[model samples]
Target chain A: MIALYRVLVLVGLIGLWWLISLQVGGVIIPSPPATLGAAQMLLAEGRLLPALGDSLITFLGGYGLAIIVAIPFGLLMGAFAPVGKTLEVYVFALAATPRVAFVPLIIVFLGLGVEAKIFIVFLGAIMPILINTYAGVLATDRDLLEMAQSVRAGRVETFRRIVLPGAVPFIIAGLRLGATIGLINTVVAELYTAVRGLGGLLALYGNTFRMAEYFVIVLMLACIGVLVAEGLRLAEKRLVRWKSGS
Target chain B: MTEPAAHVVLSGVSKHFGHRDGTPMAALTGVDLTIATGEFVAILGPSGCGKTTLLRLLDGLLQPDTGSICVGGAPPRPGPETGLVFQSFRLIPWANVRDNIDFALTSSGLSLSERAEKVDEAIALVGLQRFASAYPGELSGGMKQRVALARALASEPQLLLMDEPFASLDAQSRELMQTELMALWARRRPTVVFVTHSVEEAILLADRVVLMAPRPGRVIESLPVDLPRPRWGYDVHGHPSFIALRRHLSERLRELVLTDPGSDFFQRGAPRS
Candidate 1:
């Protein structure tokens, strides 16, 4: 029944798009069928998939590195007040700053390459991961820590069993949020100057006013975002099944 | 049943907090207590009487500002020799019942096989055998507290410190746990220090109940419950001596709360400072 509603919604959206395209004419807006045909052409010509591959490489590198660095760093900051106090200002500043502003700076520093694209994505992704992990670590239940202390649990054991596991939910939440923003940054980074990826393709097709192709690429980006977010959600539910009393 | 041995001793034990500025807040002061081996003692008092603090001191989770506490002929320190059960039943949400109990035995240098056996035994002892793999979140309030008790017992500690372990349970579960605790104590006989606010609970469990006063908390009275062993919960509550003791203690507790200046919570019925 839910699937049927979703299919109906899709049909409704396509009908609306078709109506708009007819009224506006195909110059600025293309019909849903035109976009689908364009998507198939792009797929057959090996244009879309390779761009997707390129985008994914940068996204994974930046997002993965962010996760690796941010989680441990956040843990330290959250666990120790001295570290948190020292680095808190910088983390907040980066997190608050509009990351699109860094595109030009990244290009200047790293040049127009995969490195620049990855750096921008990292900047976009790192803060959410860091903040969430920090919050998670700090949110370790006081009673749990007291229990650990009373039991004479060693420092390593306490961290491994208590601290890390306690923070898993928060870390996963951060990763999901980071992956989404990281993907956005990847496209933005590519759009600026880098010669490959979906963002670069979007820019080329956009400049030439290939409305059907542009719409197709945008649809692909949206699909990728939803897929990645859904994947993380499923993994989180599996890993922390006890959280919901399952 | 056996000759009493000094398993725990606290002399002039004074603890203060918030001393960073100048005037420190004394949580406990001049507390002197001695617990014999295999004794079950409960420290009973109102809020701010430092009962929990006293229990923590016994567990070596906190140190006194002045004076000394010794457990098993040594200065108090956290180790496998002592186990603690918190009021909230702080089992790790991520760990199952068996694992939560096994946690207490982690540093005992026991082999995997031995540790597993101890874990299973503790679970069975708590009658949580069927829910060995259930997480704390999955268990009811009564069951969670049982897991906490099991975890504390798993290490086979010489001393067990509990801070109002059953205070959160419903009245029925509380009474059931009281009987179960009596049964468990009869079996293992660990030197136990339980802190609680309930008069009936203190009378029900402890061999001796130590009453504490607030405002620089100190031991005010110590009474021995010469109640017979195998004291059934429902019947014992109606016993003549039980009635006399309960009446006296309950009246004394009410008078203390009403008259004592430190008992700010009951100041409405008392002369104001």
Candidate 2:
């Protein structure tokens, strides 16, 4: 019964969409089928896949760089009061600003190339991950830390045994959120550049007034973001399974 | 990394905690104690009685304001001579029980193979051999405490400090753990300072139970329990001698607690048996 209800709900949405498009004319409303067909035609032209592939490379590289830098800094900030105080307010302020606002500025500085796009993606993705990871490390149990000290555990071993394990779930949460944002930022980065990612395609489709094809690319990018986020969540679940067992 | 020598001395040790807003809050007064190698001493007191502070002083986690603390022929060295078991178990959430035990042994001068062997031995000693791979979160309350014990014991510390390790467990589990601790202590006699409010646990386990009084914690009574091992844990329960010792210790603890029940920390909690 629940499955039937789910089917009916989904059908109702699609039926409404189709009704609106057919009644108002596909030229104006652009039915889902027309968008899908346009997407297929764009793929047949053999451009979408490579463009997406290039976009992902930039997305991942930028995201990876941000994470690598953010992780150690975040950990340092959390563990040390002076460092956190010095960096936290400024970091949050920077993160709070929308990355889209920086595109024109970034383009002027780095030019309309992969570097600029990657920089934009990095700007978008780093702060939340950095902030949340800091919070995670900061919230680690002081008792457990004292336990490490009571044993006279060397500083390195203390980090390995206690600090890293304690901060993992939080780090994973930050990373999952960052991955989706990184993808979105990648598209936003490409929206102005000559780079052939989905964002660039959206721009090209827009110039030609082909909004249906643009809509298809947007859906595809949204799917990628969801898949990436879901993957991280699964990994977090597996990692924390041991914690729950005890 | 000093040699794992064996000495723990608290000479005229005292500690004070300020208020939440940083006014003076004395936690310990001038107190002197010496725990020799292989001595099992229990610091029995009601809550906020500076028993934990004394233990921490011995462990070098806190400094005594008025006195000096020395461990292993010198002042507390940054190495593995003092292994502590907290009430909360405080196990690393990611590591399994085996890793938790092995953590204390990491800085010890044991080879990898030796560490592995000792980890297994400790698990067996605590009767947690079957759950070696299990994480702390998976274990029952009793089992978590046992794992805590195993972790402390695996390092083969000359001094072991426990802050009411069994206070959280049920009657059956606590008794079972008491028996397990005795058997293990008999075999690997580390000098132990176990802090607890339970007069029964102190009497049942300590070579000497140091009864502490409440506000600005001070040692009031030091009663000896020289019950020889292989002491049967079940038979020891309500034994005439154990009961007599429990009564003596409880009377002292009650007096200390009632002196200033105004502290509000020890108001609503476990009664000393």
Candidate 3:
């Protein structure tokens, strides 16, 4: 039922956009059908697939790395009070500052390569993952910890059974946010240097006045965002099955 | 009564929590007590009375500031031989009833089959077999506490420490749990230490109610309850000495508040136990 309503809303939005495009009668903003046509052409020419592949590779590298590093580090800071106190200020400082401010320095140091792009994505995505994970670990139910302690559950058992599962909802929320931010950073990285990926195509088409193709790339990016978020939501539902009714 | 073996001994145990302004607040002071095997003792006191602190001392969750505690001839520390049930049913929200019970068995060094057997047995013991796969969030308050009870009992500890286990339940459920607890205790009879503020509850469920006075908590009185065995669903209110003992303890607890300057004004017109 919800899916049907969602599809209806999307169709209504496209219909409105199509009507506006027809009324404007300009190449600047293409109609939905024209954008779809450009998407097909890009796919037929094999350009869309490769750019998508590149974007996915960069996105996965940065996002996966951020998750791997930030979660455990955050857990460490949260589980141990001394570590949390020492690192919390710096983490907040980094989270507070604009991530884009570091892009120039990252590109300058790492050069206009995949490494720089990955670094930019990492900088964009890492803070949400780190902060949310920290909050999740910090917010672990004290009563549950007391229960575990009273039962003499060792460190490993406590972490595995209590902390990890307790932090799942927060971690999944972080991953969803990270996915979106990572995509945005991927575009910023590519647009900055005009090097590769769908962001490069976006810039290439926009520069040449191929408005429909540019819109298609933007549409694909939106689709990718939706897919990543939907994926995380599905995984969360599976992992946190006990949190919901059967 | 036969002289049972002394399973827990506390000698001059004291615990102090640091206040923000630097003055230390004594939670428990020079608390010396002995609990014998198969004995159910209730530490009854008001809010500030450190009944919880005493229980935590025995559970080894907190170190005594100035003394020693021994359970089963060893210094107290959380181990497989002891189990603790918190007032708040601390069942893991992410785990089902069976898994919550099995969690207590994690460090027990038992094989998977043995753990499963124990977990199932405990689930049955608590009458939670129907909700064996239910999560804490899905269960009622009473069922959740039952799961907590099952979790603590799954390890088959020689000593069981319960910190106001039924305080959160509704009156009806609390009464039911009291009866169930009595039945369960009648079966295995572990060296149990139950901490609560309810005078009647203490008498209903314990062999002896150790009353602690607040304001630097210390045991001021210990009264033996001559209630019979298998007291579940028994007319505790109709017992020969029930009203007399209840009224006496009630007055004594009230007197403690009345004498204390801090509790004087507030305790006036306050509800009685």
Candidate 4:
């Protein structure tokens, strides 16, 4: 039933877009069919798939790197009081600052290439993952820790069995947030650095007044966002099933 | 009757915590006690009497600021030899009943099959065989505590330290758990030190009740309960001895509570009359 409503909503949105396009004309606004035709043209010309692949590479590289570095860093910060106290202010400050502001500086260091793009994505994604993981570790139940200690579980064992499992939901939440932000950063980086991914196509089409192709790029980005978000939701559900068992 | 050998001994034990303002606050002061092997001892006191602290000290979770504690003729340390149950059932919420019990045996150096056997035995002992795969969140408060108990018992600890294990349960569940605990104790006969604030609970289960006073928590008296074994089978509560001991302990407890300056009633300067 919900699926049927979702399809109806999609059709309604397309109809509204078609009506608006007729009013504005094709140069300013593309009809749904025009956007679909442009999507096919891009696919046949083999432009869209390659651009998408480039974006995927940049997104995965930076997002994956953030996961690797941020989780342990966060864990260390949370597990040790002095490290957490010293770095907490800086982490918060950096997180509060606009990530886009770092783009110029990142390009200066790494040049306008894949490295700069990856770094930009990494910078955008790392904060949420690190902060959320730190909070998760900090939020681990005291009673559970004492229980582990009472059983003479060594530090490693306690961390593995108790702290890590307790923090999983937060970590996944962080990952989900990181993923969305990472995708946004991927586009921002593509635009600012060497023109390469879907963002490049968007810039190219918009500048050339190719409204249908521009709409195709925009739709593709939205589709990617939806797919990624839905995937993470499913993963979160599977990982934290114990939480909802009752 | 010849007394069994002392399995646990604490001498001149003192533990203090730094208050938020950095002032030293004594949790347990100048505590001295001994428990015989295979004995069931209850440390009964009001809140803030450091009964939980004493249990932690015995479990080697916290070190005493001064003096010494010995369990099984060695300096106290938590291992497979010691099992502890908290007031809150501290079962890992993510781990099911069986896995939670299995965690206790992680450091036991037992192989997988051996650990599984021990876990199964504990589940059966606690009558939780059907809920072995159930998570803590799925279980009721009473069932959760049973899982906690089972986790502690899975290791077959020589010293079982329980800190108000059933205090969170409903009244009916509490009664049922008390009976089940008695049966388990009778069968395993581990050296047990159970902590609680309830005088009646102390009298019903413990072979000896060590009364503690707050405001620098220390032992005030040690009273022996001479009630017969299989206590649940008989109307132990209505027994003449049970009545006398309960009355005496309750009076002492009331006196202690009223006199303690930190107690709410005393702090409020409530009229005694």
Best by TM-score: 1
C-alpha positional error of residue A56 in candidate 3 after TM-score superposition, expressed in Å: 2.2
Runs in model 1 lying further than 4 Å from the true structure: A1-5, B1-3, B19-22, B262-267, B270-273
lDDT of each: 0.89, 0.82, 0.88, 0.92
User: Which model, 1 or 3, shows the larger lDDT?
Assistant: 1
**How large is the C-alpha RMSD of every model relative to the true structure?**
2.6, 4.3, 2.5, 2.5
**What's model 2's lDDT at A101?**
87
- The candidates, ranked best first by DockQ, are 4, 1, 3, 2
- Every prediction: chain A TM-score: 0.92, 0.86, 0.95, 0.94
Superior candidate under lDDT, 2 versus 3: 3
Give per-residue CA lDDT, model 1, range B20-131, as digits (tens).
Answer: 7888899999999999999889888888889988988888889998899989899888777898888888888898898888888878899999999999999899899899
**Residue A76 C-alpha lDDT in model 3:** 89
lDDT of 4 by residue, B1-273 (tens): 997899999999999999999999999999999999999999999888999899989999889999999998888887889999988888898899999999999889999999999999999999999999999989999999999999999999999999998889999999999999999998999999999999999999999999999989999999999998889768999999899999999988888888898887563444668
Q: Could you give candidate 3's per-residue lDDT for residues B1-273 as a string of tens digits? A: 878889999999889999899999999898889888899999998778898888888888899989899998988888678889888888888889999999999989999999999999999998888899888888888888899888888888889899999999999999989888888887878888999889889988899999999879999888889987777556878897778889999988888877666574454756658
Model 2 local distance difference test score: 0.82
User: DockQ for all models, in order?
Assistant: 0.70, 0.61, 0.66, 0.74
Q: What share of the true interface contacts does each candidate keep?
A: 0.69, 0.73, 0.75, 0.73
User: How high is the lDDT of residue B2 in model 1?
Assistant: 60
The regions of model 2 sitting more than 4 angstroms off are: A1-16, A19-25, A79-81, A206-211, A244-246, B1-8, B70-73, B226-229, B265-273
